[model samples]
Target: MNNETTNSFIVQIEQKQLLLTALWPMRFEQVQQCKSWFAQSAVKAGTLAYGADRVELGLSFANESFTFCYEDYSESFWVTADSAGGAMLLSELAKEFSSLEIR
Candidate 1:
């Protein structure tokens, strides 16, 4: 990771906020997974939308113009942009999606 390409981001959902950090080596892959997660999770959380594949993820919340997609070759599960809100929504839906449990 180099100083120029590394980036940090913050996502706010309602009153909660989350911080995310990424670097060049995995930025593209991370962005893709984040978008995919946002699309699927958002839909599941009742934030229904027509296009999941077209959703975009960003490394910075300041600018919102980056396009993202899933990269099957990635090795991690990362979320981005609206993830804070998406996480809260998903957390609320988890109770309804309860098919299994752990102790």
Candidate 2:
């Protein structure tokens, strides 16, 4: 995990007082790809929140929020959210990339 990028994302979430309700582990490349898909798919449904580094990305949909960050110990990226809808949307997006393991 890149401390600078991770901390930036954490600060944003804290400032928003968002609750993390779900987390999905994925590779760095996978996370990037997911970010692109999200930016395209949610363009009509929500707003995109992109940080300085490509790894720090998020989406706001309705009342839910989805964020991409790194899991330090796992040395991998994770997609976190504040609601089940976020998880559902991620699942739907992952369907387009069979290699992505949502669990």
Candidate 3:
């Protein structure tokens, strides 16, 4: 990506504090899959919300907004903003969940 696009994307990302391609929610059932994936890592996820039919994952990592959160109520996975170094960390995490099905 060019500097302009990258900078612009970064601006947009900061504005929203997330990296959502299209704002579509995931299926609630995917929580099971997400749980399994998260379990493999030692990182602890913060609970944003939860109920009989809803749950939300929120966590701040390394004193940054770098988090991989999923909301059962909204059924959406939200990627928090990350620095260049954080991106590298996320890249490694990505290798484990290679088959992320976005809905």
For model 1, what is the error of residue 68's alpha carbon versus the real structure, in angstroms, after optimal superposition? 12
Candidate 3 TM-score to native: 0.38
TM-scores of all models? 0.21, 0.34, 0.38
**Candidate 3, residue 69: lDDT:** 55
Report the lDDT tens digits of candidate 3 across residue range 1-103.
Answer: 2111121122123332443332344466655444444444444455544556655565444454455555555544445545665554553333333333332
Per-residue error for 33 in candidate 2, Å, reads 11
lDDT per residue for candidate 1 within 1-103, as digits (tens), equals 1111112322222223222223224444234344234332322222222233332334222222212223334422223325444444433332221221111
User: What C-alpha lDDT, on a 0 to 100 scale, does residue 55 get in candidate 3?
Assistant: 50
Candidate 2's C-alpha runs over 4 A off are 1-54, 60-64, 71-74, 96-103
Q: What pairs collide in candidate 3? A: 26-75, 55-72
Q: How large an RMSD does model 3 have?
A: 7.6
- Candidate 3: 10-residue stretch with minimal lDDT: 2-11
- For lDDT, candidate 2 versus 3, the one ahead is 3
How many clashes show up per model? 0, 0, 2
- Top candidate (lDDT): 3
* RMSD, every candidate, angstroms: 12.2, 10.7, 7.6
Q: Model 2, 1-103: lDDT tens per residue?
A: 1111221122112322332222344455554444444433432223334333445555565456766554434444445655766655544333322332232
